[model samples]
Target chain A: MTRFALTIEFDGGPFMGLQRQDHGPSVQQAVEDAALAITGEQVILHSAGRTDSGVHALAMRSHFDLEKLFDPFRLMEGLNAKLRPDPVAVTACEVVADDWHARFSCVGRRYRYLIRNRRAPLTLTRGREWLVTRPLDAKAMHRAAQHLVGHHDFTTFRSAHCQAADPVKSLDRLDVRREGEMVIVEADARSFLHHQVRSMVGTLAMVGLGRWREEQVAQALAARDRQQLGHNAPPDGLYFLAAIYPDD
Target chain B: MTRFALTIEFDGGPFMGLQRQDHGPSVQQAVEDAALAITGEQVILHSAGRTDSGVHALAMRSHFDLEKLFDPFRLMEGLNAKLRPDPVAVTACEVVADDWHARFSCVGRRYRYLIRNRRAPLTLTRGREWLVTRPLDAKAMHRAAQHLVGHHDFTTFRSAHCQAADPVKSLDRLDVRREGEMVIVEADARSFLHHQVRSMVGTLAMVGLGRWREEQVAQALAARDRQQLGHNAPPDGLYFLAAIYPDD
Candidate 1:
């Protein structure tokens, strides 16, 4: 048996998520089905991050073991050929050691949220970015984001359905900047509670819009209650940027 | 009556073209119908550029006259509301002098062509860029583009359906550059024959792919025969970037 590590990119608008579900299609299901058709074996695919619906990914890492031996390039080409019309592509594929893992061995993850701050409706960027008509103070939002940059209980920012054993996690970076009419928020952490990035971005948006003061974000984090969260940004603008592993 | 100039943007994927046609819907029809719904009067729209089907626009200048007085902002908002479900937007609007014409007064036009030069299939930019799997030499392409950047009889690049009275046109700028995985071709001119930009881009692509030498481009231009043209790129990657006027 051989384990292959794949770097995948997908426009998550059509899939339920990166994980498989009984309710609808998913990126995992699509790749797994393609693998089955290629090797005539049912295989389970594991990913570094599980995204929500409407969330995009630039380079998601995943791994699966196959009993049949095939060239790495052939496997990639075959899978891509079968995953057609699904808005998903395997950009890179390579053979990895047996001990390497996709999820458990990952050390960091990064996400970016895109907000189009404009009154005009989006034409080329529709369905790809969150459109916010009101002007945003990106500098203020950046200042407020500094309040949540250390180890703390993120209960206020986590989803109720999150299954992490603990609410405590260290945030490495949180940045907000304006690029013309777009406001971009970048977040990085060793790990995150479900909905943590979206929750943080949504609350920071309040600061950008002057609905919440800089200190108020710190207060909400101290509250340690999900109900205290100002907002939860939509999944449309969130993108899983990259996953960091020791081997890479 | 008031003459208002509008800066419009559209995806152009769903419409037939910028002009009104009996066979199918168009950007002109959409805006004209929106005006009718708002002011209860028939309105005709004149644009600086008449883009073909599948050609997008970043800011297309246009104008219309209306008997009903309207605040510029209100007119823009109402038209946007009525042009719903279509991939079009009125980005800017202002009252212009009665003599200001959308087409006749335009002094310059700029266009940009986007090509995704990579082996991987496009996920996020599908239908928005021309995907070429072959590796391209952008520096070589740029060197060849200089051959077509001057006064010339562009019969080889003009389409058979072109309505221009003369084939002679002054080309101001034609640049080719690579940005990451994408190659952008930008062209500027006082005016162009129909399909001229696409044809130039197509011929340049052959140079980029090492199929034609730099001098062959000059030879093709001197041939003044459409049959000698290398290729014509698809309209999917074309964009009417902007139109320039003297008063602006």
Candidate 2:
């Protein structure tokens, strides 16, 4: 068996999620369908991140096993042609070892969340970005986010349906910066619980609004209770920016 | 009568064009309907630029005369709210003299066109940007554009459907620059003949592709015939960036 690793970019607005669903279109289904069309074989793809509906991915990595030896570049071209109008693209394809797993082999994941902190309604990027008419202080949000970095029990930021065995996770980096009328937040972690990034961003927004102090975030993480966090930031602004793999 | 000048921004993907048509939605109809819905008075709006279908506008200025005095800011807010979920936006509004016209009073018009030159398919900005899979040499294109940036009869670059009385027009600036995988072309002029910018870009693309030399563009302009030019660039990448008005 030959394992093929693929780097992909997708607009998740039309997808139900990365996972296969019974009723709606999904990124997994789209890729699997394209792979079947290209190789004439059914394959299950393992993704580094299972993004939710309305989320986007710039460089989401996935891997699949096939019995035939096929050119990786040709696979990318064929998959792209079959994907059609769906906004999903196979950007890069490479042959990997049979032991390689897109999810388990990933050492870290990077995500970017965008907030248009202005009064003007979004005309060009309405569904692609989160529009927060309220003014946000990026400095305040950045200062607040620093307290939550490093190893912590992230139960307060985890989703109720999160399937992780433990609430403890290590957040390697969290940075918030402003560009023009937009506020961008970058987060890096080995792995994350469901909705963890959104919850953290939601709490940071309170700091931006001057409603919560920077120390509040540290205290909430220590509490490890889900009730302490703010609302979940919408999926529109959340993007799976990249995934890091261990160098052999 | 109160003459109100409004700044507009819209994603023109769904509309026929800026001008009203008998079959499809137009930017003019969208704005006019919004104005009438707010003020209960029928008014005519004049725009600085008449953009084609699938073209976008960043700050297209327009003026309309109303029978009643409505707070310009309030009117903008009302129109934006009543525009429903459409991509049209009334960004700003101010009262002006009755004689002020959006197109005739404009001293200069600025337009920006974007082209994403890369092998990868566009996922995030599909309709907002033009995608070119082939590599383009921005330096060559820029150098070639200098030959046409002065007072000249631009018959080679003007569309046959243009209604302008004279083809001789002075170009203030024509700049081409590359930012990452995106190539941006900015042009400023008192006015432009129909499809002038698109035609110039088409010929410049040939220069970028090594199909035509830099001197060929000058000869094409001197030919002063529409057949001398290259293909018309698509409207997807064109933007009515802004309009400059002389101080009263």
The candidate that wins on DockQ is 1
Clash totals, every prediction: 0, 0
Candidate 2 lDDT tens digits, B31-64: 8998899999888889999988899999999989
Where does model 2 exceed 4 Å of error? Answer: none
TM-score of each: 0.98, 0.95
After TM-score superposition, what is the CA distance of residue A195 in candidate 1 from its true location, in Å?
A: 1.5
Best-performing candidate as measured by lDDT: 1
Q: Judge candidate 1 against the unseen true structure and give its global Cα lDDT, from 0 to 1.
A: 0.94
lDDT of 1 by residue, B120-215 (tens): 788988888998989999999999999999999999999999999999999999999999989999999988899999999999999999999999
For model 1, state the Cα shift of residue B159 in Å: 1.5
True contacts kept of each: 0.70, 0.60
Show model 1 residue runs off by greater than 4 Å.
none
DockQ of candidate model 2: 0.66
Docking class of 1: medium
lDDT tens per residue, model 2, A1-248: 89999999999899998889898999999999989998999999899998888889999999998889899888888999999888998888999988889999999999999998875578888878888878899999999999989999999999998999999999999999999889999999999899999999999998898888889989888899999997689999999999999963
